[model samples]
Structure formats: structure tokens, C-alpha cells
Target: MVTRIAKCTCGQLQIVVEGEPLGVGVCHCFACQSRTGSVFAALAAFSPDYRVSGRATDYIRTGDQGARFRFRFCPVCGSNLYHTEEGEEHRSVAVAVGAFADPDFPPPQDSVYDCRRHRWVKLPDGVTVYEKDPE
Candidate 1:
């Protein structure tokens, strides 16, 4: 599979993702809302080998499993890049789907942490929905 790249608005940060994402989804969960200051967050899952260029800052958050997930983004424009499990061993990343420069990016396959999804908001039909983070 061919790798695709996504870059920050200022081109300061670029991420080269290997192949397609494992999944993509919108998270209406409160955590996402608070973090993004929006109703929902769109995410694209990728491999940990995802290569990122440009300086980034990390904000570690304790996930539902108590494992710290490090969110990395460009320090310049604050463009959210990817989230990862701490330690250099994990093999996956969840990229911010909105970061894609391509206007034709694929849609999400599932919605997670829906138990905390905003009641006023509604996801579209046909995608998998999970009350909590899907295992």
C-alpha cells in the first residue's frame, strides 16, 4: 500500500502515514469536546511508524485504561497530529482526520465513547457506535 502524507497549515509539521488508517470516526465524547472546544472530533487511525516532521509538543492524558496517551501537535500552529501510547513500542497512532490536506479523505467506520456523546448531537446512520472506547 502506498503511504500518504498530511501537513499542517503552515507546512511546519508533516506526517507520513503508511498506507490507510485502521479506522476513522467522529468522537462526540466530552473529552474530545473539551479538548477541541467543539461538539466532536474526527480521528484517523494509523500505524506508529507514521513519520512526523517539525517540532511538536506533547500533552499526555490518562486514558480509560490508565495508560498515558501522548497527543502530539505542531508547536507553531497547534495543528493536532497524532495520539500514541507512551513508550516507543506501540505500533499505532490516531491521526487527526481533519489534518488531511486531501479533500477526499475517507469517512469513519465507527463512533466511540458515545456514552458521553452530546445528547443534542446525532451521528449519521450505518456506522458502528460504542458507548465507551472500543477494544
Candidate 2:
């Protein structure tokens, strides 16, 4: 029942996640790289029942798999905070792991879209990797 707090770069938007996350993963798809402007994006998924205490803006994008995703970001610093996929049961939301700024936070257990993974990027040992989405 540990609660974790995630915040945007500017600290204007804060989210409080209750209990534990359903899953944690890293995505190395082209879309994720472009959206995050990084080699990969790390996320911690929760049951969309968290509490938010600030304003955010939503940006919608279509994934390569043809699924629609709504990305939520802090309006002040434009830091991507969380996202939700279309038709997702439980309305699960994946929060940016970096937003927590806590090294103690659980690490990613899985890696997706590894086909697009950078050649130099090395994942920790024993992590489950997929060439594409696990689904």
C-alpha cells in the first residue's frame, strides 16, 4: 500500500498513485522515441484511479498498431506525464517513470518494440523483451 508521487518537470502537475503499479516497462518504438525525444521511454502503469492536483493537456496520436493513444502532459513545462490507449479495459494509464525522480522506484520488468531499440542501448539482465507489443 505504498503511495508514490510523480510530478512534471516544472512541478506544476503532480499525480499521486495509490498502492502498487500493475506493470512497468520500457518502449523503444520509433513513436516512443519521437514523442519522448529519447532512445526509449520508461513507464509505470496504474489503474487510472490516481489523483491529480494540477492542470495538463492531452495530445492524441495513433500508434503504429493503429491504436489511438491520448498522451497527457503538463501544460507549463510540456513534460509528458501519462497516456492511455483506446479501448483499454481498466482504463490503465502509464506514467512516465522519470517523472517520479526516484531511483528507488521499481525498474522496468519488460521491454517492448525492441526491433527499434538502439544498438547501444543495453537493458538489464533477465528483463522480458518483445519485438513488438506483447499483446
Candidate 3:
């Protein structure tokens, strides 16, 4: 299994993920835009086997579907590092792909909430596009 380290902007929080991610995707929902302060968020999903170290803070918010999301950020630099959704199976946690700072990391396989995606934002070719979350 390959291992990768993801760290907060100030290096105050670090996470070590074992093996490749289960999936990678992009989200363009309003909530994601607000949380990321960007047009979209690129995420890599990992199972519960990942380990986190150092100090971090969490912000809990309810989504449009009434699903709760817990966002974890660095206490020092306030960089959003990862998040977990309520009742998600496999104890999956979605981490900010930017945290890895690896240009060679695999591209996202899915782009969701395309309905809210900015008209100027260009998605990579060949990704599965969803108007909303895939059921």
C-alpha cells in the first residue's frame, strides 16, 4: 500500500493516509463553494484507516438535504483539511486534494452538482458529470 501525507497550511495538522484513495471527485454545490471559498472543491476519499495527528478544529453544518457535515481545519492557519458526512458508510473521509501538493495525483473521476457549476469553470475531459449526487 502506498502512503501519503497531507498537512495543513501552517503545518499544525497532519494526516497520513494508507493505500490509494477509494475515489476522487469534484463538488460544485453552493455549500462546497462557501466552504472552500472557491468555484469548486476537489476531494479524495479515504477509508477510516487514515491517521491524523496534531491540533485541528471542526465546524459542523447541515447541508441542503439535512445531512450533517463535519469540516476539520487547522487551528493555526485555518486551512480546511478534511470532512466527513453524517451516516456515510465505510467511515469515509474526504480530504482536500490540494493538501497533498502533488501535481501527479490522479485526476477526479466525477464532477457533481454540475447544475451549480460555474459556466466559466472547465471540467476535465471524460469525467462522469452529475447534476447532483449520484444515487
Model 1, global lDDT = 0.80
Ranking by TM-score: 2, 3, 1
lDDT of 2 by residue, 20-126 (tens): 98999999998889989999999999987888889989999987768899898999999999888978836787899999998888888999999999999999988
What does candidate 3 score on TM? 0.93
lDDT of 3 by residue, 29-64 (tens): 998899889999999999878889998899999876
Full-model lDDT for every candidate: 0.80, 0.90, 0.91
Candidate 2 ranges with C-alpha deviation above 4 Å: none
Clashing pairs in 3: none
TM-score of each: 0.86, 0.94, 0.93
lDDT (0-100) at residue 106 of candidate 3? 89
22-110: candidate 1 lDDT, tens digit per residue: 87898876777877768888988887777888888889888776778788878898777778878743767887777786778987789
* Higher-TM-score candidate of 1 and 3: 3
